[model samples]
Target: MSTFEQKILSTIETNQLMGSDQSAVIAVSGGPDSICLLHALCNLYDKLTATCVYIDHHLRPDESALEAKVVETHCLKRSIGFMSITVDVPAEAEATGDSIEACARRLRYNALEQVRSDVGADIIAVGHTADDQVEELLLRLIRGSGLKGLSGMGFKRGRVIRPLLEISRQEVLAYLDTHGHEFCHDSSNESVRFLRNRIRLELLPVLEQRFNPAIRSTILNTVNILKQEEEFISAESDRFYRSLVRECTNEKDPAGHHSISFATESLTTIPAALRRRLFERACWETGCRPDFQHIDTIDKLLAKPVSGTELHLPDGVRVVRQHDSLLFTKLTEDQGPRESVAYTIEIGQEIEGSGSYVIPVLNRQLDIWLSDSDPRDAQLMRIDRDTITFPILLRSTAPGDRFTPLGGPGSKKVARFLGDRKIPHHLRHLHPVLESDAAIICVLGLEIDERCRITETTTQQLHIRWVKP
Candidate 1:
């Protein structure tokens, strides 16, 4: 066996990248690293079920075809199963603002995944060398990365594994040279337009020439240390999220919004380190990864008086303090108080004025109109027409109001009801209320006035239903 094949055998065994009988596909890009991976995998084809997939991202139309042909010829010489897939990337990538490198990489990986599934391959192999790892570390360090970013690419990300990370690019090139197989080179790699190209071609060589030649080793060390710190940070973050959150039920919407509040005492109780972790993970979980600026904003919010103060975060996200708990929500600028349309809903007609609006009145009888008839019998109530105050105003909940509340008694103030239920700050403004400019009428799906209950001597009955668009 050649030196490349011998090296692959050792690394594969060490990493448990592939068992003797297991199936794997090598992702060959016709580049030096992948070309070496293809050859090494082919050398062990007798022991392992190995195939090759070449993704032709149609950047250079003629060039891709030529490369695919070369890969096919190489595989044919070895009697290996070879699959080549073509994908258009340049136009689409430019439209999406992704650099050519990034778009091609994403497209190639996706194609390889589909091919892997089709071929019943358990693992997909990539040829990422120690040189690539070092480059990534320097690149990430330059970009102002945190622990996650500083940690260079893992050997395995999802189903793709890089067993050759321990190998050097020179070692792979040496093997290809010995075997008399020249790999396809991309001309775009010479361009200085992208930062990565300059880093890989110019900065790395100069550093290796003048500075510590063992920079790659320390780069690898940095990644390993960062990974260790990352694990501890993630664990502490999970603890913080668990420790600081409590749930409150919203009665306005049965499929109610969840209100997550961080108790000031609980937050203050956590160490400063844990506080940072808590905020970081909290932002990530809520789909808004708070940057340094956002973290500063959060810190400012924490310093605020613990009343009902709120802050609108970037990306339509909001952070608010209600009493003792901090809440995060996705909300927008109030669209100038929910465009109201009061057309005096008539009976026996569907009024699609503003959402599911319909008021059907009968001579002491019943008329119902709702989006779903899936029996909210328990949530439904009757009202006496004479007892109900007229000029019923339909609007979102306001402060200092009281309603009997569905499935409850003795009338709870609107603010108290929302607070006890933990209605999310965003939804609180959107929750519909029905009030008669007097006492609040049944807060739509919440409750009906005791005086409005249908009794023995009811003359007229108005059936009102709440709905959505």
Candidate 2:
């Protein structure tokens, strides 16, 4: 057995990458590293059943096809099962709003997953070397990554195993040369436009020449240390997380918004590092991005002694500090049953303006206004007929629209009122408004104009109802 084959076998056994007599899918890109992996896996074990999958990202027209053909011929000569799949990476990138690299990676994994399911493969093996790990560490560092990100890629993540993670690219090329193996080189790796390529080709050589001659080994060592430390922290954080989270309910309100609560005192008692981890956990569970600034803002909120403080986080999540608990709730969409399309409504005429808008009769019997109204209710205000004009326009909120919000000291900008309420920016245009004399009388599903409020002297009322969608 060659040195490369022996090293890979040892790495696999140490990592327990695959079980004895297991089926594996090898992702071969016709590159030196992948070709080495294929040969090593095939040569090292007879019990292991392996197949090759060549992904044609369709980025390069002729070169990509040639690379696939090379991989196919090699697999055929070795009596291995081979499959070539084509993906429109550029089209997928445009559709998903992802960069070319990100989109290609996502689609490639998806295609591999499909093959894994089809073949009932126990694991998928990819040729990611120590060089890739070093590159990733630097990439994450430049991007301001946290501990988890800094740990870099693992030898095994889910069903994907990297037997060559401990091996260097130079070692791979040497192994291929010793075996008289032919491999296809991707020219894109030389392009400076891609960050990874630039890091691999430009930054690495300069660092090796000037700073550390063994920078790759240094990075690998750092990654190993950090990975071990990060694992300990993550496990401890999860243990504390379950205890800190007092209540988690998905069926809280009618809208099915998820709510999670943590004891304020208990949360603050946690170590600063673990506190960040716990907050990150909450953000992940709530489908919110765990941005450093956002997490810091939330962490700072825990220090405030005051209660009833509310913060609107990204992804419509609202964090509220109660008396003894911190509450996190994903705000439900304010879409009401009423359509927000603007149309003029005549007095005493009932028109189904939108799904939420309805004109109810002036009962004046059942006192719906005697008690505090549900702010989310889409009910029409009781405006005196004589005090208002014949035609009251119900339209989507527009610029320059102002309203005297009920119980407010004075008139405020409709936009300002919506902003104060923590309404999401995208949903602002869908908010309905009732206009009279070029003035906003009602900001539907929120507040009615103070002037339109019912009084004892009022003889007639125009009841407008706004229902939550």
Report the C-alpha lDDT of model 1 over 234-345, residue by residue, as the tens digit.
Answer: 7877766764554322122223333345777677677766777676665665546576556665666776775666554433345676677677654332211122211234
Candidate 1's C-alpha runs over 4 A off are 1-10, 13-16, 45-47, 235-264, 271-274, 289-292, 306-317, 332-469
- List candidate 2 segments past 4 Å from native: 245-253, 305-308, 335-469
Per-residue lDDT value at 106 in model 1: 81
Largest TM-score belongs to which candidate? Answer: 2
Residue 62 alpha-carbon offset, candidate 2, angstroms: 2.0
Local error of candidate 1 at 283, Å?
A: 3.6
Rate residue 30 of model 1 by lDDT: 85
Alpha carbon lDDT at 232, candidate 2? 96
What local distance difference test score does each model get? 0.65, 0.74
Q: Model 2, residue 191: what's the lDDT?
A: 93
Q: How good is model 2 by TM-score? A: 0.69
Across 352-399, the per-residue lDDT of candidate 2 in tens digits comes to 211122233221111111112224333445554435542346566667
